[model samples]
Target chain A: MHIPDGYLGPTTCGFFYAVMLPIWAVASKIVKKTLKAKQVPMLAIGAAFSFVIMMFNVPIIGGSTGHAVGGVLVAILLGPWAACIAITVALVIQALLFGDGGITAFGANCFNLAFILPFVGYYIYQALTYRAPAISNRRVLAAGIAGYVGINIAALFTGVEFGLQPLLHHTAAGQALYCPYGLNVSVPAMAGEHLLIFGWVEAIVTALVIKFLQKQDTNGFPPKTCGNDTVGLNAETTNGRSL
Target chain B: MSFFKDSVFSDENASKNGFLQSLDPRIKTITFLLFLVQILLTRNIFILLCLYAVSVLLACFSKIRLGFFLKRTWVFIPLFSLFIAIPAIFSIFTPGEPLTTVKIAGLTLIITRPGLSGAALFIARVVTSVSFVVLLNITTKHFELLKVLRIFKIPQIFVMTLGMCYRYIFLFIGIIENTHLAVKSRVGIKIRPKKGQRIVASNITSLWQRSYQLNEDVYQAMLSRGYNGEPLVLNNFKAGWQDWLWLLCALTIFITIR
Candidate 1:
């Protein structure tokens, strides 16, 4: 979900930027140490894929169409750190190139979509599929659950942020400075939508992609070490040295 | 998707000879960013409306369609802020002088004067801020905007990543469209949901493999040109007096509003 401008006050936006800057710094460092020349294009393509995936429209239960935010799917295919960078890039493009998201609220959007969504999704996927056969249906099930839980948690965080705005910043005459809805209204609106509708979309997308990945290349998900053969699919080509 | 085509339309506008298109990208970016911040700083409906009027004037000078701009900006305001601001319009959220009262069933809904103004101000701010962003994007080329970002000292790796990502997105878009068309052809009239999902999944897998192969070929090409991590581009940054004048005008407007 893209949080537009004027929804969050300057204080809240500044705080998120403070938190996100360090995380982005660490992400770049990790990405530099772990990735190499050949993988650079792969990372770029992954970022592009994350950006384009949102354009896919799927028919929901009500004959209405909606798209999934493929944050967790990227994390499952690549690592969580790379997913953070990819999603942050996608969010930036959306803000600058299109008017889809706000410029000041970019940090807050990344905090939800980049950090929380993918990290939670990746960990849950890892935890459930641990010691299980890589090609089994159980891994796909775990991915689905991870997708469900990950988006729900991120949605919860967004709801809390929206709810906190009115409480923290308001006029002396009891007028809200930023977001008008308090926790009472904001929490239910955001969390309910994600829990019932968006979460399932995410879960279904993640599981389908993971299943396809498993069938195509069984060794794609559990990427570990930094060499030509261990990064991801077609490992033989990723021979660029990573320091 | 119409959303994809929207960018194509904006790109066409970016190349047009117009007031905003002629300005330096760095100047346009900074001025728009300042305008966005000023828009966010106020909760006054009048001032917000004034800012929106100025943006509309600028859009006119930029030669973009005003109806399309208004349609894009207004459609989102109702969908997003309307729901959030609905509770604010009632006395339950922010109590004030009751403008009107209606009784439905057992409950009374009191529309408050201050609550109405508060919701109006919030929606106004959102509208004004988004308009500035829309104006900037529809006017400036994407690469020019990225180069302006580089001037701001954003990390090289991040900028590089974005550049590469921007190039590859078009390729992936084609692949996705082709795959969908192929699936539609094979499945005939009515499509099965399960089979559609499988095709989408498989397309993603093949896309990944193709990206990896493309990466190898691209990397080798770069190496042949003696490429390292840092790609050196010829920097020909020259800011004309018009750029400074635009910045001064933007600041004057901000100060007058403040």
Candidate 2:
């Protein structure tokens, strides 16, 4: 979810920006070094797809519409480091172009959606499907589970951020100047929605895509092994170029 | 599908001759950022209303339709914030004088005076902040916004990635939409979830392959043009006297408003 301006106080926003700067720098360096010059266009395309993927409204049971975040999907296709850069680029573009997220809260948004979601999702997927062959159904299920868990974790962090605002920043009258909700309210409000609705949407999208792709191409996901070779633990490390 | 049209990047108002459109992107970004910070810091509801009125006036001067601008800014974000603000109006959250009371099933809900004021201020801040961001977006070109980010010493890699991404986003959208339409035409029968999943997966896989193929084509094109990996940007920023005057006014307002 995109956090708008005035949601978090200046101090909280600043803290996230400070924390994310180094992570972004490291991610960029890893991506530039591992990816070939030709792969630049592909990475850009991936970032663009990350931006547009949210537009696809998935029809679930109960006649409700929800969208997939596509953060973990990018990580499954590309490496986690590349996913970090790609999703961060998408978030930045969304903030600047659409004002979907806040200008001041960009760092906090990126930290939640880009860094925490993809990295956690990728690692969890790897841990679960470590020994499974790339084409197996279990690996596909792993991707789904990973997507579900990753986004929920990110939402939890955001809930904490919103919940902490009132406690951390207030006027002398004990009135909240920023988000007025405390931990008890904000955490359940954020986590409940994601856990019940959006998490399932993300899981279904991820699982279906992975299954369909594997059926089409017997070689399966991660068509290349560029960055995956360097980070040998990921199970998606097959024989395709970085997409 | 909403993906059929690009709603995020609005350039309809940017082409029009307006005060905000004429301002330097750098100046617009900095001053508006200051305006947002100031709005957030101020706890006084009347002062918040004044700042919001000023934003509305700025929108009018920018020559954007008042209804269109308000709808664009408030339709989604502020509406969502309203739900977040709802709990703040009850005395259970913030202690204050009881404006009214409601009881249901042995539960007492008191609408406190301070709670209502607090929620109102929160809404005011959200409304004002979103207004500034929406104004900046509607007035400036997408590329110009990316370029203005350079003024803040944002990473060049980010700028390059964003520029390239912006260009291909339309292309990818075309590819995706065409695939969906093609699938719809080809399938005469009502498709089940399994078939639907297969179609979506194949579409994504094809798109990935196309992206990689396009990447090779772009690489060859760049190599043929003697281009290096480094991105070369055209710096055409010329800050006029009016831009400076605008910036100065912004600073004065930011300071004096406190």
Stretches of candidate 2 exceeding 4 Å from the true structure: A218-221, A225-243, B1-6, B102-108, B184-202
The most accurate candidate by lDDT is: 2
lDDT per residue as tens, model 2, B60-134: 999989998898889788898998798898889988778899886899899887778778888888888888888
The residue pairs that clash in candidate 1, if any, are: none
Cα displacement (angstroms), candidate 2, residue A205, comes to 1.4
What overall lDDT goes with each candidate model? Answer: 0.79, 0.80
Candidate 1 backbone overlaps, count? 0
In model 1, which runs have C-alpha deviations exceeding 4 angstroms?
A218-243, B77-79, B102-108, B188-196
Worst 10 residues of 1 chain A by lDDT: A234-243
Residue A71 lDDT (model 1) = 91
Give the range of the ten consecutive residues with the poorest summed lDDT in model 2 chain B. B1-10
Maximum-TM-score candidate: 2
**Steric clashes per prediction:** 0, 5
